[model samples]
Target chain A: MSQVPPEADLATQDLPSDERAMLERLRAGDAAAFEQLVRDHGGRMLSVTRRFLGSEEDAQDAVQEAFLSAFKALDRFEGQSRLGTWLHRIAVNAALMKLRTRKSRPAEHSGDELLPKFLDDGHQATPASEWRDGGLAALEKAETKELVRRSIDALPESYRIVLLLRDIEERDTDETAKLLGMTSNAVKTRLHRARQALRALLDPHLRGGL
Target chain B: MLSCRELVEFLMDYCDGELPPEQREYFEKHLACCPPCVAYMKTYQQAICLGKSACKDEEQKPPKMPEELVRAIMAARQAK
Candidate 1:
């Protein structure tokens, strides 16, 4: 006899009644339901697109594209994931597409500058200093928040995008890889390098803030 | 003992708790004798935490999605 994992069995069940009803309404071309869906998920979707696209015009365009893509693809939605999760993925893909189509500028290539330096013997060239006692609590200050935001923005585009997808969006390696059209190993390598660079960038301020 | 350079390379895996058991043991043993690596690891983790916190603030106060954008999206869909 085959033994189904409990979680897998749960996944195969229908989405909750309200969500199911909403899906049906959407399928039936209910305009109000569609409006509700956009209003409900639009803000987060916009935020995500803005981070990836940077330009206000591009972000708005990406959000519009994402919602439209989601609407057209409603019939393909499976019950395995929440509608919001599914929508989020579409939004990320929409942003990526916009990024692809954008006019190419010279690659910034700043990742090496921001990455930690090591001695020939494989030790950090610069010793790390202890940060101030506050840790994340210091983010309460708007100034500190802005500093962190700017540091992240300073990373090279490729590394920044990976950092945003992996660290900020909280996407898993496989999903991130699939979205970025990279291998899982490539995703991990980029993620690691991004973190190391970010750490180096933040060190001076975080350390002095103490 | 893992060299500080090797430890730096493994920082992500060690922090993610993805390091194999034997490797993790070696990583920690190095940390025990290495103040600089410990400090590096701490700040590395703090950088991630600060980033997530800062970004969460941005999401919590998302830039308002223009109403016109919504109308535009609906219009585009209808036109299609």
Candidate 2:
């Protein structure tokens, strides 16, 4: 019944002693270790928060909150989880906390409109376009990456967060459902639709290449 | 074999490996014969990949970790 995603644990054993070293120092309340932890992990944590919060200021605040919380909880830390993984989980929670407090924006366009329409006869109403062949490798271009980011931002917050947590953050389905107070089935549906809607948003830009 | 629409309904569950054996067989069988559906699934999978990579720090913004944050947290760490 362990719902922790496998990716959440990462590979602590393979990581050189630098992480273990840091963990020990920080657990001892060594100030420099704490600072170094923030410095090393802060960029990634901020990126995680920004994906959820959108606003730069809120993202930074959330990262800071997560780090401070992690610092306070140090003695409870076991060696089983990677320092990065534990910090990543704390950062996700911090971002979600920020998300909970912020006033939600006005609802965007209908997600239903973004899904592929099927005919009454149970066939796709439209033909699939030929996407550039490299799959996501096509997104390696900086310009395309920006487009992907903009397309995600265009999604309504409700579905977008589900996509972020389940696919990007790689939380298990049950965990995501619990986080959003929905059932696992509901999480799966929303995650699918969120991916669909995001695909719709990207379709226009991809013209020949999503 | 499942129809295209039936397969569409199964797509998420299929990808999640949630489809039970008989249904899973039928789902794969449908994809086996249906090239359009095959293309659709590939694009869908790619979109997920795109979504996952969209927000990495390397993709957006400078690498600068905040200095103010470091100072604030360090001060708090020392105060404890």
Candidate 3:
């Protein structure tokens, strides 16, 4: 048997009864239940969509589309998962669809430039410098956060999307793979390269922040 | 006996604790002597911290969900 990843437990951890009731109410066509669903889940859904689409208008539209789709398929909801998780999946799907339909997607390119370089003999060509004492400690500063956000936004779309799904969302590799329609190995590879690129982007600023 | 380049490849797995026992020992041994690698690892961890912190934006008042969005969703359901 394949050993389950620890994060798999997170998926099934909190199958709360309240979400079950919410799902029931939603399926029964209770307007209040519908309103509650929107009011309760809308903010987080918008946040998820925003990370993917990066535009307020696009994110709002994606969340609206997700809620509509979820409402239409209420009868198909099996009460097995929390209503929020199901809706979260729908929202991510909607966001990806929005991304797909955009008229001007960012052009594709290899991220090899951002990855570390090694000499033919396997030594680093240019060794990474140690950040000045506790230089990285300033990462939580609002200015640093803003820089981090921009660095992430600067990545190529495919790598950025995987990084957001896996790292920012803290999603399991399997869920990310399923959402992005790639093998788990592919997701891991993209995530690794994304992290490497992001580190390279942030290094100088973090060192300067020291 | 992992080279610096080889050890860099093991980083994600090393942080994930997915490396086998022998390989993990070798990775650590390499780390003990390599300041650059140790710094590389710290920055790597910092990268993950920054990435996860991006999600904290959701916990705040997150630019109010569009006022028309719920109404639109309700209308869509009614039409369906």
Off by over 4 Å in 1: A1-24
Q: Docking quality tier of candidate 2?
A: medium
Candidate 3: lDDT of A80? 52
What tens digits encode model 2's per-residue C-alpha lDDT throughout A18-90?
8878877876767778778888888777777887888888888888788878876766666457777778788
lDDT of 3 by residue, A52-138 (tens): 888878888888888887777776666456676677778877888888787785565677898999999787888877665544467
**Segments of candidate 3 deviating more than 4 angstroms:** A1-25, A76-82, A100-104, A132-136
Candidate 2 A-chain TM? Answer: 0.84
Instruction: Write down the TM-score for model 2.
Output: 0.83
Best by TM-score: 1
Instruction: Return the lDDT, model 2, position B41.
Output: 81
Range of the 10 consecutive residues with the lowest summed lDDT in candidate 1 chain A: A1-10
Candidate 2 lDDT tens digits, B1-80: 57787887778889878889999999889888888788778778777887777666353453578788778767766676
TM-score (chain A) of candidate 3? 0.75
Please provide, for model 1 over A1-210, each residue's C-alpha lDDT reduced to its tens digit, 9 standing for 90 to 100.
Answer: 101101233331379888888989999999999988888888888988877877779889988888887887777676667787777777877888888888886767768887778899877788877788646767888988888888887888888899999999898899789878899999999999999888888888888783
Worst 10 residues of 2 chain B by lDDT: B54-63
Q: Tell me how each candidate scores on DockQ against the true complex.
A: 0.69, 0.53, 0.60
Q: Where does candidate 2 stray beyond 4 Å?
A: A1-16, B1-3, B21-34, B54-62, B75-80
Relative to the real complex, the DockQ score for model 1 comes to 0.69
